[model samples]
Target: MARWQPKLGLVQETLLLTLHARALDAKLPSPILGDTLSAELAGAIDYDFGRLKVKPSLVATTALRARKLDDVVRAFVAVHPECVVLDLGCGLDPRMFRCDPPPNVGWYDIDFPEVVKLRSEHLPSRSHLIGADLTESGLLDDIPGDRPAVIIAEGLLPFMPGDSFRRMTRELAGHFPSGELALNGYTRFAAWAMKYHPTIKALGIKAAQGFDDPREPESWGAGLELVEEQFLTRAPEVALFPQPLRALTRLTARSTGLSRQGARILRYRF
Candidate 1:
């Protein structure tokens, strides 16, 4: 197979990281992210992201985060059957199929125009796909505000600067009268380190901003409240990790400082 060089949009570029991580996860004796679609996508693209060297711990972290986001979307839709679910920066993730929103539930997967074009050719037509840059406001206008809403940004926050993140929050919160927002949170140091991380650097991606405290999002609006902060390493799923790695996570989970140093699935209500 010829090596396929990806000319993906920013959202698509970032989302493909999960697919790569999923591929790495498959190599594990025990795995976290088992999205067969992700594997298929990688194969279809003939992706050759040479020797990124992802640590099992990192792969486990990715899997755990994806799983939790899946759970949050599921729970949110369950309560509000008529809710509008907007997946911001949704690049080729089969979350709609996984969550299976009811017919009444409106699902919109928004990313760059080109990514949406490619996604239209590959992904099943269930939810509506919008091609727009999320950094700009007004795109949310197309989504209905009458129903309860759920906004999810899986692995996107760290890529934006603090001001931009705040603007995004304000725009999203302003769009829906009441809704749930969920994302993977990163510490300031982790955000800075991500830019220099061998894997991220090799992918030609840069870290724009990060917050040390999860509560920082609250400042975006008084309506936003911190509902939960999920520590993936301590989840029951960690027990499913491969040998040696499972034991290592156990130790990391026991230490409060060490666990917070890792990725977080942050849930908020507005």
Candidate 2:
């Protein structure tokens, strides 16, 4: 095995696939993710965004889903202007640039220290970057406790074990008096499939925790209540999906059972 150290920036890690989606959006008639920054970041990093080889269909799917997730976070913050928004395990995503919350909103982008060090080297200085491990770092203490909170966990849960996921949730709920959490829910099949997914397998990434039911988080603690469920297949965003696949995604989204098997974005409030 090659013993090369994995050198990657925070945005670089996320751009692995999302950058391809951004390029697709630029060529499409209608783009789901209107993130110009992602493209620019990919350029700044001199990354071969095109070679990601995310099929056009899958690229569109990811873009559309990302757009929807962006909307969810924006809406939650809008309602709670005093909210502290934390992007857990935030790789190299320029969400802060995309969302651009008001001056009073406290936004945090948390990730491994190595990733943050790379981020500091390439990305502009942002007040939100917290370099620490989500699993064990006592970083959340740095966040002010006086405000309401909103947590964004996109593409994060699958990387963590069930116990770690549960424990983190418990701590987060305890830290913030009241808040909302939005995350992409993975199914057991999705978790198993991740072990074989080409790019993921290449990175030696494995999925650890997945739930068959959207409401499964309720089992973890009484502090959370299921508020909304978003199945990508049914969302109007599917209209942006690449030609033939749009119909298929729409059909799958309409089926409650099938939707559960596919990627899901769920919300909970505490």
* Candidate 2: clashing pairs of residues: 10-91, 10-92, 11-92
**What's the lDDT of the predicted structure labeled candidate 1?**
0.79
In model 1, how large is the Cα lDDT of residue 231?
82
How well does each candidate superpose onto the true structure, as a TM-score?
Answer: 0.91, 0.89
Worst 10 residues of 2 by lDDT: 1-10
Q: Compared with the true structure, what per-residue lDDT tens digits does model 2 show for residues 123-162? A: 6766478888677747777899778888888777877765
| lDDT tens per residue, model 1, 1-270 | 333556875435766777677766755666676777766666777555565656666678887888889899889888999999988878778788878888999999988787888678877789999998777777876788788888898777877654877888888788778999998888778778887877777667775567777788888764789999888778999888876988988888898677776777889999
Candidate 1: TM-score? Answer: 0.91
Q: For model 1, which pairs clash?
A: none
lDDT of each: 0.79, 0.74
